[model samples]
Target: MIGMFATSKAGHDKDTVYIIVQEDTEYVYLADGKYKDTEHPKKKNKKHIQIIKKESDDILKEKLIKKQPIYNEEIRKAIGGIVCQKQM
Candidate 1:
């Protein structure tokens, strides 16, 4: 609810890292490598993806502290950071 990082728990993007750009009652908007940016986020069922709220908070804070716009590459970086942390 407060983070941007997530992984596709199901569907075509399964196990793929994504940044949650938007969310609604039944769906959540996601972005990744193949996905362009938050401007064109992918809408998927909430149940279809796993949320990674903890790791993304740092990146989110960095973005806010730097006052940068939410861009596609930033999303990838945020997701990538989480993935890298998980692997270590």
Candidate 2:
């Protein structure tokens, strides 16, 4: 379930959280796009992404359905929160 808010654990994107825009059996199209306000999604191997949690998806999906923008900061906060929770 490498969807929105998944973080990169390996490869060129290590340590960056990304929003997964599309996926397949081997790879996912990630939008680090919010970083520059352009739709530059990087496609990476599925195994490279770390799933911290699915806690953000439902909320984000609701916002998406309402046509609200999901900023990079929100994704960063979600990942940061989840990582903190796991450390506890």
- The clash numbers for all candidates, in the given order, read 0, 0
- Candidate 1: where are CA atoms >4 Å away? 53-55, 58-68
Q: Candidate 2: where are CA atoms >4 Å away?
A: 36-38, 57-59, 62-88
Q: List the residue pairs that clash in candidate 1.
A: none
Q: Candidate 2: lDDT over CA atoms?
A: 0.64
- lDDT string for model 2 (1-88, tens) is 4345677888766877666655679987776544532155687788888765554657765664464667766556655666676579
- In candidate 1, where is summed lDDT lowest over 10 consecutive residues? 59-68
Best by lDDT: 1
- Per-residue error for 72 in candidate 2, Å, reads 6.7
Compose the digit string of candidate 1's lDDT tens values, residues 13-50.
68888776666799987767455465677888888888
Candidate 2 lDDT score at position 39: 50
